[model samples]
Target chain A: MIRKHGIKLTSVAILIAVLVAWEVLPTALDVPRFIIPTLSDSLAELQRMWANEGLLGHILSTALYTVLGFLIGSLLGAVMGYLLGMSKFWEKVLSPYILALQIAPKVAFAPLFIMWFGYNSMPKLLVTVLIVFFPVLVNVLQAMRTVDRDLVNLARAYNLTRLGIFWKVEMPSTVPNLMAGLRIASTLAVIGVTVGELVGGNTGLGYLISYGGGQANAAMVFNAIILLTVIGFLLYVVLERIEERVLHYLPKAHQ
Target chain B: MALEFRNVSKSFATQGDGELLAVDDVSFRVEEGEFVSVVGPSGCGKSTILSMTAGLYQPTSGEVLVSNVPVTGPNSHVGFMLQKDLLLPWRNIIANIEFGLEARGVPKADRRARAMKELDHCQLSGFENHFPYQLSGGMRQRAALARTLSIDPEIILLDEPFSALDAQTKLLLQNSFAKTIKDAGKTTLLITHDLSEAVLMSDRILVLSERPGQVIAEIKVDLPHRDQPIRRRVLPEVGEYAAQLFKHLKLEEKAA
Candidate 1:
C-alpha cells in the first residue's frame, strides 16, 4: 500500500515537472507559435474553444463513435473467436483471411471507408470497428486454445456435458486474456476514429486537429491533441478497473 | 474386484513413426475398499494405467472393468485426482470442492451440503469463500481431494497427487488421506514415483518395469497401522518394501 502511494506521488511529480518545462521551454527559447506553442497558449485556446466553438460537441461525437465501434467489434469478435476456437477445421479454413485483414494496416483503409460511406460518421465508426476486431479475435482464440488441459480432463471425469465443460472451464479461463485484448482494442478504437475524422469527417476532435493544422493554428492543434489523450486515458482506466474487479481471484503478478 | 485391468496394454502413435508402446500386457485387480499403489521408475506408464481405468484412454489391446462391467467411457463410478491440485482459479475453496457435484447436476442445496461436509472433513471449514489462489499448496490439495470425494465415486485414482508437497506436508496429507479413504471405504489406485509413499499408504504395492510397462512384482504392505503415515515411514516393514521396489526399478532401468 505504501509502495502504491509512493508510485502515485512520483507520477504526479513527474507530470508537474513536464507541464512546467512545456510552459517555460518555448518562452526561454523564443520558439515561434507555429513550431512550438506554449502550454499556457494551448490551455487558453482550449478554454476559448470550449466556451465559444463547440469543442464539447466534437468530443461527444468522437466518444459516441468510439463506444459504438468498440461494442460491436468486441462482441462480434468474441463470438467468431469462440466458434473458431472450438472447431479446428473451421479455424484452419478461415484463418488466412482473418490473418490477412489483421496484417493489412487499418489506417490505410480510412480513405477507402470515407469514399464508400461518403464523408459521414459512418466511415469513422466502421474504421473504429475494423481496428478493434482483430486483437480481440486473436486473443480470445489463443485464450481458448491455451486453457489448461488438466481442468478439461477433470470436467470430463466428472461427466460434465459438452456445454457444461465449455461454460465451467473454457469460458472462465479465457476472461483474463479477453480483458487484455479489450484493453488494447479500446485504445485502438480511439485512434481508428481519429484517423477516420482526419480523412473525411465534418465534426469531431479528429476533424478539429486536422482543421487546426491546415490553418497553422498550433494552439488549436495542441488543445485537440490534449483532449484526445485525456479520452484515451479515461477509456483505458475504465477497462483496467473492470479487469481488476473481474479477475480479483487471480494471484497478482507481483506476488 | 472394484477395478480390474485384464491383460491391458496401450501404445501411442508418434509423428512420422510407428506405434510407440506405453503399457505392455499389464494385468491387475483392486479389491473393493482396497488401497493399492503402483510405483515404478519415471516413464513406466504408471499414469497410463490410471487414465485407462478412468476411461480417459482406450487400452489399445485388453479391457478395463469396473464392478463386473466393461468400461466404455468416463462414468460416475470413478474420480481421478491429478498431480496438480487443479482447483479452478476462479472458484472459491467451497466452490472448487463442489465442482464434481455441480457437474453431476446435483441440486444446489444438496451440493452445498455435501461440499460443506467435505470441506469440514478436509479441515477447511472457514475458507469457504476464499479462492484457490489465497490458499497454501497443502490446503489446495486438500480441497482437490474433497472435490474428488464429493461425488461419492466408488473408485478413486490418484496420480502422484502429493508429489509436489514438501516432505512434512506430504506426510501430513498422506496420513489424513489414508484415513479418509479408509473411513469412506473407497477403492483406490495410486500412481507414484515415490517408493515410500506407496508403502506408507497402500495395503498392497505393485512395482512396474520400465517403458512398455508391465507389473514386475507385488508387495503386500504388512504394516500394522497403515493409516499412520509418519509411524509407517519409520517402520522396518516400510523400509523393506521401499528397498524391494527400488531394487526392481533399478534393475529395470539398467536393462532398458
Candidate 2:
C-alpha cells in the first residue's frame, strides 16, 4: 500500500512540476505574452472569457456535439459491421466502397459539409460522425472474422439456432473489440468536432481557438486548448469505467 | 444399438479438384448403455465419423444413426465433447453448464436446478460461480462434463476429450468420466488415438486403418473393474490389449 501511494504521489508531483514550469518559465526567459502566456495570464483570460464571452455556452455546445456525434456514428458503425459480418454477398459488394471511404481524410470534408449545411451545428455534427465511424466498423468486423470456430461448433452441437449462435457466441466474442473501437472513436470524436468548429463554426471552444489566434491572444488559445483536453480526458475515463464493468470476467495481468 | 454406422464413407474435395477419401466403408454398432472406443492413427477419419454421428457433416455414401434414427442435422439426442473444454469465457461455470438447456428453451429455474445437480455430480459444486479461467484445467474439463451431462443427452460423443490433459489429470478424469457415464447408463462413443485409454474405458475397442479408415479389428475388453479405469491400468490384460492394437496399427502403416 505504501508503494502504491508513493507511485501516485510521484504522478502528482510530475503534474505539479509541469504547472510550476508553465507559470515560471516565460518571464524568466523574457518571452512575449503573445507567444507563450504565463499560467496566471491564461487563468485571467479564462475568467475574462467566462465573464464576457459566454465560455460555458461554448463548452456546452462542443460537449453536446461531441456526445451526439459519437452516439450516432458508433451506432451506425456497429450496425453496419454486424450486417456485413453476417452477409458475405453484401460484404463482397460493398467492401471496395468501404475501403474508399475509410482511406479518404474525414476532416477534409469539413468545409464541404459547411458549404452544404450552412453555418449551423449540422456541419460540425456531420464531420464528427464521419470521423468517428471507421474505427468502430473496422474493429468490430475484424473481431467478427476472428471469433473462435470451436465455440461456434460447440454451440451448434447443442443444436443452437443461427440467431442463438450469433447472440451467445459471435456477439459476446466481439465485445472486447467493440469496446476497444469505442475508446478509439471516443478520442477521435473530439477531434472531429474540433475540426468542424475550427473550419467554420462560430460557437464552440474550437471557434474560440481560431478567434484567439486571429487576435494573437495566446492566453485565450491556451485556455481553450486545456478545456478541450479536459473534455477528451473525461470521455476516455468514462469509457474505461464501462470497459471495466463489461469485461470483469477477464483475468488481470500483473506487471 | 444406440449408435450405428452402416458402411459410412466420407470424402472431402481437395484443392486440385481431387476427392480425398477419409472414412471407407466403416461399419460399427455401439450397444445401448455400452462404452465403445475407436482407436486409430492421425488423419484416419476418426473425427469425421463423430461429426457425421453428430449430424454436423453428411456422409458421402452411407448412414449414421443415433438411437436407431438416421441423423439429419445437429442431432439433439447426442452430446459432443471435444479435446478442449470449449467453455464460454464470459459465463460462470453454472451458466456454461446451462447453455445447452437454455438453447433448447428450457425454463430458467429447471435448467438452473439441472445444472446444479450436474455440477454436484461432477464434484464441481462449489466452483459453480467461478469463471472458466479461474479454475484449474481439470476443473474446467469437469465443468465441461457437467455441461454435457446437464442436457441429458441419450448418447455422449467424446472426441478425445481427455487428450489435452496432463498424464495424472488424464487418468483421474478418465476414471471419473467412466464412472459417471456407467452409473447413468449412457451409451458413449469415444474416438481416440490412445490405446491404453481405449483398453481402460471401453467395453469394445474398434481399431481402424490409417487413411480412408475402415474397421480393421474389434477387441472386446473382457476385463473386470470397468468403472475404475485407473485401476484397470495395472491389469496384465490391459497391456496385452494395447499390444494387440499396436500391432494392428503398425501392420496397417507398413501396408500403406
Candidate 3:
C-alpha cells in the first residue's frame, strides 16, 4: 500500500537498458562473427534449438539431474542445519568437514565422481547435490541457532513443550533465512549438474557447451550460456515465489 | 494458603568473587483472587520475587507454596506476562492466542472455540486474521494478555507488564485488565514501577527495598469496589495513597 512496487520498476528499467546495450555493442564495434557474436546470433541459435524437436529433451535431461540434486541436498541441509544449530557439539564436529567440502573446487571433484558413479547422469546429480547443500545447511543452522531467546523463554514459561517450542517459535522465525538458502542452493544445483556434465557426459546443456566449445563455435557456446542463465534464473524465480508465499509473515529484515 | 514464600533468601556467587544477596529473608502471602502489586526501587529484585512466585527460581533456603503445593519449576497453574508483548510474528491474532492451547494439546475445534471466546472478551474479535506487525503496540500487548489467559491458569504473574506502554495506553489497559479479571475473579500478582497503577488496581501494595528485596511496607488500598473508573479517578484518596507508595520507594532508594 505504501509504494510497494518501487523496486520492481527500477529493476525493469535496468534490465531493459542492459538488453539494449547487449544487442547494439557488437555492431558498433564491427566485431567478427563466431568470436563475440551479436546477441541476435545467440537468439538465432536459441530459436534453432527450439525448432529442433529434442532440444527440450536435452533441457529436460539436464533439468532431471538439477532438480533431483536440489531436493535431496536441500532436505539434508535443512535437517542437518536444524540439528547442528540446536547442538553446538555436533556443529563443532561436522561443520569443519562441510566447510572443507565447500571450499574444495567442485569442478575438480567432477572427474573423481565420474570414476565413482559413471559418466552418465549420476555424477552430475551428485555434483548438483554437493553444490546446493552447504549454503542451505549453513544459512538454516545460523537462523535456528540465533532465534530470539526471549521468545523461547516466553514459550517455556507458558508451559510449552520442546516440540511446541520448535513449531510455534523456532521454525517460523527461521523460515525467511532458510528460504534464502534454498534459493541460492537451487541455482547452484543447476551449475553443479552442468559442471559435472562438462567434465564427462554425452548429453545435457553442459555437453552441448563442450561440443560447441571444442569446435570453436562461439555462437553455439554463447547460445548454451544464454539458455543456462535462463534456466537458472527461472528456477530461482519460481523458488523465490514459493518462499514469498510461504513466508509472508516474516519481516523484510530477515535476509 | 493461597500462596506463601517462607524466609526465601537468595544470593549469587561468581567465580573468585564474594556472594551478593539479591533477596534477603523475603516472605509474603496473598489470599485467592486477590490483586497484589510488588513495588520497589528499580534494582530491588521485585522481578526476582515475581520469578520466585512463578516458580522460575527457588529462594535459596525457602519454599514457595502455591495452593499449598511446592513449586519445582514453572507452575502449571501460573501464567506470566512481561514488560514487552512477545507475540510470534508468524501467527495471526487468533493463532497467537491459540498457541498456548496448542501447546496444551487442545483439539483444533475446541481451541478455536476458546480463542473465539477470548477474542470477544478482549474486544479483538474481528481482527483475528491480522498479524502482530499489522497491530499497534497496545493491541499487541492486549493480544499477549489474551494469550496468557487462554492457558486458563489460576494465577497470573505480571513482571512490569505495562512499563512499555505510553502512559495513556497503560492506564487504559490497566482499567481494561481490572474490569476483565474482576468478572473472571482470577488471582493476580502484578509487579509494577508505577505507584498509581498499583494503588488504583490492587487490593494491597507490597513496597520493597533495594538490593536484597524485602517487603519494607505493605499498604492496603481501601478504595470503593463498585470499581467504576470515572468515579475512582476523581477521588481524593487515590492521590494520597499513590504518594505514600512513592515516598516508601524513595526512602528505600536512599536506605541502600
In the range A159-186, model 2's lDDT, one tens digit per residue, is 8988999999999999999999999999
Best by DockQ: 1
In terms of lDDT, which candidate is strongest?
2
Candidate 3 lDDT, tens digit per residue, B1-256?
4778888888878667888888888888988989888998888888788788777677788888889888888756888888888898888999889887776779999999888888778878799999998887888888888888888888888888888888788778777788777777778898988787788888998988888789899999899752444456677999999889878777566777
Greater-TM-score candidate between 1 and 3: 1
Report the Cα lDDT for residue B129, model 3: 98
Best by TM-score: 2
Candidate 2 regions exceeding 4 Å error are B251-256
The TM-score measured for candidate 1 stands at 0.96
Best-to-worst order by DockQ is: 1, 2, 3
Could you give the TM-score of chain B for each candidate, in order? 0.96, 0.97, 0.93
Clash count, one per candidate: 0, 0, 0
- Sorted into a CAPRI-style docking class, model 3 comes out as medium
Interface RMSD of each candidate, angstroms, one decimal: 0.8, 0.9, 1.8
Measured over all alpha carbons after superposition, the RMSD of each candidate to the real structure, in angstroms, is 1.8, 1.8, 3.2
Ranking by TM-score: 2, 1, 3
Q: Which pairs in model 2 have colliding backbones?
A: none
